[model samples]
Target: MKTIGRRMRFYRTIGAKLKGGEMAAILNISQGSYSDLEHDHAKPSSDTLIRYCTETDINIFWLLTGEGKMARPIGEVEKEKEENSEISIIWQNGMVVGNHQVDNDHKYLISLINTIQAAVNCGLGKEVILNYIAQLLSYTEVHFKREEEIQRSIKFNSLDEHKESHKRLLDQLISLRNEVGSAEPGEHQKAILEILFNDLTEWLFRHMLDEDLKMTEYFNLEKNHRVEDNSEE
Candidate 1:
C-alpha cells in the first residue's frame, strides 16, 4: 500500500491487538505521534516500521507491500490460522452512535467492508471486488437516505449539511468503484483495491466518529432542554 501507516495500524490492532498507547510504547514514540501515523497524518520512519515488525513478528514484506500473510507464524497452528485470516476491522462499543437504526446500518457497512477486504486478502481478483463494491454502494445509498430521514424526523438543524456530506462520500465511492471496474487484472487491480479499501475504511470510520456521533449530541441536548422546560413549568 502507498500509506505504510494504514498497514501498521492494521497489524497493530488486528494481529497484535495493541492499543495506541501500547503500540506507541513498542515503537518508542509518543501516543499522539502514533495516532497521527495510523490516521495517515504523519509518515513513520523506517526504523519505526522495522521495530514494530521485529517486536510483533509481523511479516515486514507484507506490511510494506500488502502481499502475503500478515503474521510470520511462530507455530504451526498459528501459521495455519494466519494463512486463512484476513485483515479486518473489529467493531468497538465506542463506535455506537446511540441511534439504533443508524448504528445497525453502520455495523452492516463495516461488515461489507470487511468482506471486500477478505476477498482482496485472498487475491480473489477484480470481478469479486467489483461485485462487493457494487453491493456496498447500493446499501450505502439506502443507509444515507435512512439517516437523513431520522435527522428530519428529529428536526435536526444540520440535516442539509449532513445530506451534503453523504453525497460527497457516495460520489467518492462511485469514483473508486468505477476505477476498479476499469482496472487491469494482477498488479494494477491489486493496487486499486489497496487504495479503495484504505480510503473507504478511513472515510467511513471518520464519518461515524466525527459526523454520526453528532446525532447523539443532538439527542442529549434535546433531552436536557426538555428537562429545563419541565422545571420552568
Candidate 2:
C-alpha cells in the first residue's frame, strides 16, 4: 500500500479525527499542503510521515514497509508511562551566572528546557513535545550566539575552548532535531528522545555552572582591576 493514493489516504484517515490545520501544524507543514497530501495531489515529506506515526499509534515500521503490525503494542504505552524521570528537575535561581543579560538568556533557555521536560513528564502529546523541542533548538542558537559575542568582547582566555564546547552542543541539537523530524517510531525512537533530552538538559547545567561561571569570574576580575588602577592613578 505504498502507492501514493493509498499511503496518503491511509495516513489522512488515521488523522481524520483531527482538523487538517491541526495535523499540518503538528507536522510543521501548511494546511494547503496537508490537504494536497490527503487528496494525493502531493506526497508527504519524511518529516510529515514521521510526525504522523509519532502522534498516532501507527507503527512506523509497518507504515514504511507494510510488513509489521500497523498499531504499536501495549509495551510502548507502558514504557511511555514509566520513562518520565526528572531530567534535571526544575530550573532554580541558583542557576544564575552573574551578568544580567546572560543570566536572562539562560533563564529563558531553562524555561524552554523545562517545557520539554514537562512534555515527557506529563505524558503530553507527541506533537506538543516536538513543538517544544523546536522552540528549544531555535532559542539555543540565539543564546549561544549571544554568549559567544559576550566572550569575544571580554577577550576571555578560555574563549576558544568555550566556543568548541558550544559547537559540540549545537551538533547534538541539530542531530536530535533531524532525528525527531524524520526517524520512524519504535523503541529506538523513544530511546533517542530520552537520551537527547538528557543530553540537552545536562549540557545546560554544565555550561551555566562551569563555562558561564568562568566567564563571569573573568569579567569580575577585570572590573576590579580597572577599579584599583583608577584609584591608584
Candidate 3:
C-alpha cells in the first residue's frame, strides 16, 4: 500500500502538470496538498484520488503498481483493441433525442464508462478502485439531476417510471460498493472489476436502450409539433 501511494503521487504530479490548476480546483484541494501528494508526504482521500483520475488521462494501473506506461500508448494495436471492445453504452441516434444538452450529458456518461474500462484494465489495488467508484457515484448524481429536470420540462408521461429506473441504478451501485468494502482488500479487486465489466455494463446498456430511448422519442415528437405549429401560424 505504501508503494501504491508513492506511485499514485508520481502519476498525480504528471497529471497536475498536464491539466494545471483546473484539476486541483475540481478536487477541491489546495495546490499545497497536491504538492504533498507528489512529494509522498500526504495520502489523499478516496474522493480526491477518484477526482484526479476522473479529471486526467493518467493510467490507473501505472499509478498503483508503477509497471505499465503512464498512459496507454497510441498505436494501431491499441486502436484495434479499443475498436473490438464492447462499449458499456451503445450509442444510437434512436436512443438520443438530438437535444444538444441531453446529448452532451449522454456523451459525458459514455466518457465515464470508458474511464471505468480503463481502470479495470489497469488492475489497480482495491483502495484506488474504490476511490474511482466514489468519483463515478458523485458525477452520476449530478447527471441524474439534470436528466430528471429535462424530463420534467417536457412533461414526459413516463417520468415516474424513468425516475424509478434511476433510483434502482443508484441502489445497485451502492450495494456493489458495500459488497466490495466487506471483502479483504486483496481479494476484493478482482470481484469488483468483474462487476464493473459485467453487471454494470449490462445495466447501463439496457437502461439506455429501453428507458432512455423512450424519452428521446418523446422529445423528438414534441419538437416536431412546435415546428409544425409555427409553419401553420
Candidate 4:
C-alpha cells in the first residue's frame, strides 16, 4: 500500500506542477480521488493504470516494481544535481490491438524518444548529441510509415490528415536539428535543448491523444466487428 501511495504521490506532485486539474481530466478521475490515490487512501483500478501510463509518461517499471527511480533516469544525480531537472515522460500501454506489428513499432518509437532525452541529459558532446538526434529522426520516419500503412489497410478516413500531421512533425524535428547543429556550444546548446524538450513533450502528448487515439478506436471497432462475425458464424 505504501508503494502505491508513493507512486500516487509521485504522480500527484508532478501533476500539481504540470497542472493538477488538467492531468485529472486527462485521467478521467475526480480530483478528490486523484488526491486520495496520492495520499495512499485509495488504489488505482486497471483502467486508471492504463490512463496514468498513457497520459503522464510515468515509468511503468518504477510504478509497478519500485526497482528504479520514480522519475526517468536521464542523468546521474552527481552530474547535474539541479533540483527541478527530471525527465517526466510516462509510457502508456497500447491496449492490445489485434495488430501486434503496429503495437511493437509504437513501443520502439517511445523507447527511442526516451533514449534521446536521456542522452541529452547526460551531457554528451555535440557529435554524440547529433548522432542521437539523427537516430531519433530515422526511427520516427519508419514508425510513422508503419502506422500509416495500418491506417490505409483499414481505410481509416482521417489517414490523409494524420499523415500530414506526421510530416509536419518530422519537418519540425529536422529544422530543429539543423538549428542546433549550427549553434555554438554552452548557452546556445542549452537553449536548443529547452526548445527540444518543450516541443517534443507537447507533440507526444497531443499526437497520442489526437492522432494515435483515433487509430486505437479504429482497431477497437475492427476487433468488435471480427468478434461479432465469428459469433454469427
**How does candidate 4 score on lDDT?**
0.61
lDDT (Cα, tens digit) per residue for candidate 4, span 27-64: 56688756644554244433344445433344434544
lDDT of each: 0.69, 0.63, 0.59, 0.61
Off by over 4 Å in 3: 1-94
Q: Please provide, for model 1 over 48-140, each residue's C-alpha lDDT reduced to its tens digit, 9 standing for 90 to 100.
A: 444454333454445445577655434543554356445576666656677789999998998998899888878787888889999999999
Using all chains and alpha carbons, the TM-scores for the candidates as numbered come to: 0.61, 0.54, 0.57, 0.60
C-alpha RMSD of each candidate structure in angstroms: 9.5, 19.3, 19.0, 9.7
- Per-residue lDDT tens digits for candidate 2, residues 16-50, read 24456655764556777667546653445433554
Ranking by lDDT: 1, 2, 4, 3
Q: Model 2 lDDT vs. the true structure?
A: 0.63
Show the colliding residue pairs in model 2. none
Best by lDDT: 1
Mark the regions of model 4 whose C-alpha exceeds 4 Å error after superposition.
1-84, 94-99
TM-score order, best first, reads: 1, 4, 3, 2
lDDT of 1 at 101: 91
**List of clashing residue pairs for candidate 4:** 57-89, 57-90, 58-90
lDDT preference between candidates 1 and 2, better one: 1
